[model samples]
Target chain A: AQTVTQSQPEMSVQEAETVTLSCTYDTSENNYYLFWYKQPPSRQMILVIRQEAYKQQNATENRFSVNFQKAAKSFSLKISDSQLGDTAMYFCAFMKRGGAQKLVFGQGTRLTINP
Target chain B: SQTIHQWPATLVQPVGSPLSLECTVEGTSNPNLYWYRQAAGRGLQLLFYSVGIGQISSEVPQNLSASRPQDRQFILSSKKLLLSDSGFYLCAWGVGGGEQYFGPGTRLTVT
Candidate 1:
C-alpha cells in the first residue's frame, strides 16, 4: 500500500509571492509517478504538473515546478510569481508506473493568495 | 484531444434514495476510466477504475458500485444513499502510463 502526506493543512501568501507546498510519500515500488493537482473554487480538478521517478530532472510548467527527491520520497510543488488564481486546494498524488494506474492522494493543502 | 464529462452538475438526494452518476469520454477509444470522491476540504479518494468495458476494480469497500457498460461510458451507483456519501464526485480518463484528465465533477448532497 502507498500513502501520501501533506504536512501543511493550510497556507496563505501575498499575491506575486512565491510559495512552496511540501509533500512526502511512503512507497516500496521503485518505478512510479508523482503529480500535483489543483482544485479551484469551481471545484474542478486540474493537473498542475507531474514527475516520473526515473527522471532525475524536475518537472516545470510555466509558473509551477516540483522538487522531486526520489531517495527522500519527497515531491514538493513550487509556485513562482503566484497569482490570485493560484489560490486553491493543492494535492500530491502517487501512482505506480504500471498496473491499474490507481492514484493515491494526500490530504491536500488549502492555499490562499492575499492581495 | 480527449475530454471527459460528468453530470448533473449538482445533485441533491434524500437518504435511502438510489444514486446513478454517469461519466462519458470523447475523442478516445478504450481509455481507462476512474471514479473518485472528494470529501469537504479533503483530497481525492479513488473509488473505482476500469481498464476496459465490463472490467471494474474497486479500491475501497463502500456503499457504491461502478459499471462500464460501454468503452466510453462509466457509471457509479448505489442502491441506497448515505449521509457519508455526500461529496464531490470526479470522473477521469487516461491512456497507458499518462496523466489522467478530469471532468468538471458532480457535487452530490445526500440530505
Candidate 2:
C-alpha cells in the first residue's frame, strides 16, 4: 500500500515571499505519479502540478514547483510570490501506474499567506 | 473540452434516510469515474471507482454503494445514512489512464 505523509500540518509565509510544503511517501512500485492539489475556502480541489516518476526534470508551473526525489520518496511543493489568494490547504497525492492506480493523499498542509 | 457536473451543491438528510448523488461527465468517452468523500478539514477518501459501465470497485466497505449505469454517469447511494456520512462528496473522471479531473463537490449533511 502506498501512503503519503505531509510533515507540516500548517505553514505560513508573508505575501511576496516564498514557502515550501514538505511531503513524503512509501511505495514499492517503480513507476507512478505525484500531484499537488489546492483547496481554498471555496472547497474546490484544484490541481497545482503533476510529476511523472520516469522524468528527471522537476515540474514547474509558474509560481508552483516540485522537488521530486524518487530515491527518498520525497515530493515537496514550493510556492513563490505568495498572495492572499494562495492561502489554502494543499494536499500531496500519489498514484501508481497499474493495479488500483488509486491516489493516496497526505494529511494536507494548511498554508496561510499573510498580507 | 471536458466538464464534470455534480448536483445538489448542498444536501441535508436525517439519519437512516437514503442518499442518492449524481455525477455526469461530458465531452469524453469510456472515462474512469471515481467517488470520493472528504470529511471536515480532511484529505480525500476514495469510496468507489468505475472503469466502465457496471464495473464499480469499492475502496472502503461502508453504508455507501456506487453504480455506473452508463459510460459517463456515476451514482453514489446509501440505504441508511450514518452521521459519519456527513461530508463533502467529490466526483472525478480520468481519460487514457491520465490525470484525474474533479468536479465541484457536493456537501451532504446527515443530521
lDDT of each: 0.95, 0.93
- Clashing residue pairs in all predictions, respectively, total 0, 0
What tens digits encode model 2's per-residue C-alpha lDDT throughout A1-115?
8899998999988999999999999999989999999999999899899999999999999999999999999999999999999999999999998654678889899999999
Docking class of 1: high
Q: What share of the true interface contacts does each candidate keep?
A: 0.76, 0.39
lDDT, model 1, position A31 = 92
- In model 1, how large is the Cα lDDT of residue B1? 76
Error of 1 at A91 (Å): 0.4
Model 1 agreement with the true structure over B40-107: per-residue lDDT tens digits: 88889999999999999998999999999999999999999999999999999988866888999999
Runs in model 2 deviating more than 4 A are none
lDDT of 1 by residue, A1-54 (tens): 999999999999999999999999999999999999998999888999999999
The stretch of ten residues in a row with the least summed lDDT in candidate 2 chain A is A96-105
